[model samples]
Target: MRAAVLTRPGRFEIEERPIPAPGPGEALVRVARVGICGTDLHIFNGHYAAESLPMVPGHEFTGTITALGPGVAGLEVGRRAVVDMNIGCGRCFWCRRNEILNCPEMRQMGITMDGAFAEYMVVPARLVIPAPDDVPFEVLALTEPLACVVRAARKAQVTFGQSVLVIGAGPVGNLHVQLMRTIGAAPVIVTDLSPERVRMALDCGADVGVTDPGGLRQAVLEATDGRGADVVIESVGNRALYAAALGLMRKGGHLAAFGLTGPEDRLALPILDTILNENSVAGSVAGMGQDMHDALTLLVHGRLTTAPFTRAAFPLDEIQQAFDSINDRPGDLKTQIVLGEEDTR
Candidate 1:
């Protein structure tokens, strides 16, 4: 088996290794596709603190089940699936409360352990969400990020006939636009620095799109009849965008802080306005058990589409190019590594 090993920050080596066999309660997957995102970039560039060097870092992935270990029942080889990457100690307070993402000791697949950035990878069988056989692996690879967006949508309490604004039109933001419309939000709006991305967002069900934030206030005002958005999603991870999102929300709107920011980043809210307007702010991270299930369900039913980012795949040898193209080609909402020839079609 060939694996792209992140031996050090900003470096990778295609190493040959024997196909690993799963142990008890684990499963081996013949990886078909792995999606690259900001998290992967952070890990590669040394921004995100990973457990060790020479780790196989890839979380958002989809593939075919090839083998199962002892006691791994209900999952069979040859089945296609996506994985819920977070693994928490069951005895922790947060895990006990079903908040696995908040567990004191959490080990993610790609972040902390060897993940699906290779021909074969092993994972806990319980975390694998079986997906429909008919769906393409390219599209199925998006299930993880969409799962995180599911968590965000729930945190924001997005509902029918409400105005929602997504402050970014990249991959995750594209999912937000689609999910917002599927939830029946009216006039879903998106703003981004890339005009092409904003246009792509419009095609993904954003009723309104603005390439420049300069004109976004008036657009939001006009769309919502001057009440501002009922929910604002700050998925850009920019402090300026966070501050701007506050001003774009309706009096009682909820702001979903879905983006990642620096540890030291902070913002001063307008105290009087926050109290008088009844606005609320909530932070949401990646998906957990139910969120992954719901995301898979949505994808299976065709309620969401991955048409905008199903292509632009790279092979294991071109891992570095795949990471670099993310910034080079801003309009390419998604970049993935195709692990098998069968999935590339």
Candidate 2:
């Protein structure tokens, strides 16, 4: 088997590696399509926390089960599946509370273990979800990414008929636009510095897409008759936008901060306004079973197709080209690595 290994920061090379066999409670999956996410880029750039050198760097992938170990009862050989990257310690306090994302010993497959950037990868049985029969490999591969957006939406609690603003128009932000429309059925305002991303946001059902966040805030105020947005989601991880979201949110509204900001990242806010307006902010991490289920349902039923967002594909051997395509083309939404010459199933 061939795998792309991140030997060190700013270095990745495809090399021959031994195929991993399924262990107890694990399954070996023949990779099909792997979605290139910002986290992959962060790991490539050496900014990821748990990502060490010489690791496979992919978490969003759909594939067929080639083999299943003892105790892996549900998934059958040749079953199409998508793996939830996070492996939580079941006995942790956070896991006891059903907050696996906050578990002290959480290990993400792509970050802490070898991931799906190859011909074969091993995954825990509990983390593998059966892909809907009707969903194509391209679409099923998006379930994990969409699940993240669903988690953010769940945290935001978007309400129907309410005004919502999504800050940023990247892949995650674009998903937010679609989910906000589907769940809230309300007009959505999206903002991004990239013109192409703004256009993508509009195509994804944003009522308005602006290239300037401050300008978009003004437009949101005007559209809401000066009341401001009922809900604001910051997806760009920009400190400036984080502070701005607080100001743009209407009284009693909630702000869902989904971006992964650095430890030193901080934003200023009006202390009095937060107290007087009763505004609140919360962070959302990985998805739970329910979020993943909703995301898969949407994909299978054609409600959340990523067709408009998928920009390019490359063979697993050309993984470097895929990453280059993602970085060079600011307009590109999602790039994927096609793992094999033929489909496994």
Candidate 3:
């Protein structure tokens, strides 16, 4: 077996390693495709605080079960599956409250455990969701990220006919736009500095895509007949974008900050203004069980197409090239690594 091992913050090696076996309550999966997420880039650049060195950092992936541990019911070997990266102890207080993402002892795949950037990875059986037979392995790899989008949309309380604005045209941002539309919202307005992404967003159903704000507040107000967007989702983590998002939102609009902020990140906003406008800001992180399930259901039903989101693929041997391409290619959407020869075909 071969795996991409991160021995240090800025270094990774694709080395021959012994395949791991499934422990009790775990399942051994033959990794087919692994989506290289922004978190993986952060880990590669030493910017992710939660990831430790000498770890495998691939959370979004899909595979086939080669073996199942004892006592794992409702799951069978040979089933196609996608990984749910968030692994939490069921006994935790947060888990008890249906908020496993907030659990103190949460151990995410690729962060605390060997992730799917290998020939094989072991994960708790319950965390593996069955992938649709028609869904390509590469597309199935997006399940985890899609789950995150679903969670954020829920937190934002996106309603039918509500005008929404998503800041950022990257994979997550684009997904946000598409998902919001699925729930009966009006075509979303998307913003990003990359003109290529702006165009891409238009192809994917964004009503308006702009590099500048495009007088977004003014434009949206006119579209809504003097009312602004009902919900503003800040998928871009830049601190400056926070204030900009607030400015574009309606007086009583809900703002959901889905992107993670760095520890030292700070924002300067007038509290009184936010209060007077009846504006509320909420933050959402990784998905819970329901989010994961909903993501798979939508994907399987052909409502959430993952094809537009995937841009490139690389063999496992050229994992470094995969990372480099994702970093250098602005036009690329989802860059995935093919961990198995069969999957590449």
Candidate 4:
């Protein structure tokens, strides 16, 4: 099978190798489609943790199960599924509490392990969630990221009529906008450096989209009646934006920092302001299984769709170009790699 291998930072090599067999409690999946997300870019650029080279760098993916390993009772071959890349060690303090992202030995499929950037990839059977027959590949590929946004939304806890300010209009930001609207956030505002992204966010149900910092501040203040947004979500992974996020929120607002930043990143908090306003901030990582279920339920029922936002598609051979397209086309929402025929049950 052919796989795109990131042998080092800023490079890829498409090479042929023997197919890997699923170990005990695992499954072999024939790749269908893989979404190239911000994390994929981080992995490709070697900014991700520990910087392991010569690995497959795709986690947001959907595929058909080709085979199942021993003891894998609930899954079967020929089934369409989405793999939850977060593989916890199961016997840790974090995993025991169902907080797998904090497990010290956690190995993400695309981060620490080989992910779905190939014709075939082996995934733990327990991490696979069967996708519905009628769902399109595009939606299937988005299940993971949507699950991630679901986590962020839960952390932020924005309810009906509450003001929301999403500080990024990228793919993730658009997802946040749609989720916020679905949950009844009133006058949802999206801000970005790119005007196109801001427009895209507006199309995704954001009541206001601004491209400049001054405009964002004005929009937030106006939407919240001179106070601030009830909930502010930073999705752009910009330190400057994250630093300024607290100043854009209400006195008792919460900041859900959802973007991934450098490992050594630090924040300079306004100690007195935080104490005076009773403001809170929380760091949310990727979602767990239940979040994926909620995301899939939303997608299948047509409550939310990336169909309006997702536009770019590339074949595996053009993987390099696909990565380049993210930089080349900032206006597009999501870019995915089509491994073979776009198929369903």
* Best model number under lDDT: 1
- Count clashing pairs, candidate 2: 0
lDDT of 1 by residue, 1-345 (tens): 999999889888899999999999999999999989888998999878555677989999999999999999999789999988999887888987658978878889888788888999888898888988988898888888999999999988998999999998889999999999999999899999888988888888999998866899999999999999999999989998899899999999999998888889887789899999989998898987888898888888888868778768899899988886678877678888999635734
**Top of the candidates by TM-score:** 1
TM-scores for all predictions: 0.96, 0.94, 0.94, 0.94
Q: Which residues of candidate 4, in runs, are more than 4 Å off? A: none
Kindly indicate the candidate among 1 and 3 with the higher TM-score.
1
| Model 4 per-residue lDDT at 86 | 90
Please list the residue runs of candidate 2 whose C-alpha ends up more than 4 Å from where it truly belongs after superposition: 341-345
Better of 1 and 4 by lDDT: 1
- Candidate 1 residue pairs that clash: none
Winner of 3 and 4 under lDDT: 4
In the range 156-241, model 2's lDDT, one tens digit per residue, is 77768888888888889999899888886466988888988888889878898789655776888887779988889999888878
The alpha-carbon lDDT assigned to residue 276 of candidate 2 equals 90
What range of 10 consecutive residues in model 2 has the weakest lDDT sum? 336-345
RMSD of each candidate relative to the true structure:
1.6, 1.9, 1.8, 1.9
- How many collisions between residues are there in candidate 1? 0
Taking the tens digit of each residue's C-alpha lDDT, what string does model 4 give over 143-244? 888999998888777789999999987888899999999999998999988888888788879998888877778878988899999999999887888888
Q: What is the C-alpha lDDT of each candidate?
A: 0.88, 0.82, 0.82, 0.85
lDDT over C-alpha atoms for residue 79 of model 3: 82
TM-score of 3: 0.94
Model 3 steric clash pairs: none
RMSD of 4: 1.9
**In model 3, which runs have C-alpha deviations exceeding 4 angstroms?**
49-51
